[model samples]
Target: MASNTSLSSLSILIALLFLTNCQAARHLLEETPEVESPPHPTIPTLPKPELPPVPEEPTIPKVELPPLPVEPTVPKVELPPLPEIPKVELPPKPSIPSIPKVELPPVPSIPKVELPPKP
Candidate 1:
């Protein structure tokens, strides 16, 4: 059929394209040369600067002060006592009723038919 021939021709064209791509990749890998990378430059080290020493603090003379006077004591005020509250009683909760169980009928069995033997 014409459809079968067209399909075969399409498959052959795809196969040729794949083969050409593979051949080009192989040729590029074989012909390309490896390049060397440049070396990194070295950095110079700098010397640290020295600082001058700090001067010592000057000595100060101490002076004596007079003692403070004693403070007077304060009297505390008495407060009245609070009255007691009365206790309250609550009623008991009601009970829930029980449900009865239900009974189901038995299922019937199906009958089987026997077939004749083939000749």
Candidate 2:
């Protein structure tokens, strides 16, 4: 990826150098004398034609609708009462036994070893 980006940048730099060299090498010709142009004839204006007015649209007739009838009321219905459920008592949970703690013996100390002197 890095090599590709660097190659593209190098190509762009060479192209710009080439274009600048080409533009600098070009030579412009000397200026020529200007000639006067002939005068144009004026044209007479003609009157514009008149257009006819657009026709009016016809109106639609109104329609009458019949009134809607009233709805009848419904009588209320009575339902039977539901029976009550009996409650049950649960047994008590058993207690856990306590464990007794034992004393640990002391650890023995490690003896130190003598080292030789460095040369």
Candidate 3:
């Protein structure tokens, strides 16, 4: 890649030399005047080119499109009447018995437990 870049630069230098030589040759030699000027020749007058006046920009027209038709709606459906459920009459719950109040006996006192001496 580096070699290719250097080669291109060398070729450009050669082309520039050719261009400079051609310019130098034209400067070194001048052709004799075909006719002597009377101090100065009458300057030629040229008519300026006539360009057409720019046309006015056109205006954009707006087009109105009709609104799209509405879609058909499906009627709401009602389910068939639910089958009449038989009245479920559960038997009345048995009445709870009233408990009689009773007094309990006091807990007995335990004698002091003693540990025997180890030999």
Q: What is the clash count for each candidate, in the order shown? A: 0, 0, 0
lDDT of 3 at 6: 95
Model 2 misplacement above 4 A: 1-79
Computed on alpha carbons, the lDDT of every model, listed in order, comes to 0.87, 0.81, 0.89
**RMSD of candidates 1 onward, in order:** 8.9, 13.5, 30.8
**C-alpha lDDT of candidate 2 relative to the true structure:** 0.81
lDDT of 1 at 59: 81
* Evaluation by lDDT, superior candidate among 2 and 3: 3
Q: Against the true structure, what is each candidate's TM-score?
A: 0.36, 0.30, 0.28
Largest lDDT belongs to which candidate?
A: 3
**Which residue pairs of candidate 2 clash?**
none
List, residue by residue over 1-119, the lDDT tens digit for candidate 1.
56988999999999999999999999999999987779988888889888788888898878778888777878787888878787777688787878877777888888898899999
The residue-by-residue lDDT of candidate 2 on 32-107, one tens digit each, is 4456889988898888888788778888887777787887988888888888889888899899999889888998
Worst 10 residues of 2 by lDDT: 25-34
CA lDDT, candidate 2, residue 93: 86
Q: How does candidate 2 fare on TM-score?
A: 0.30
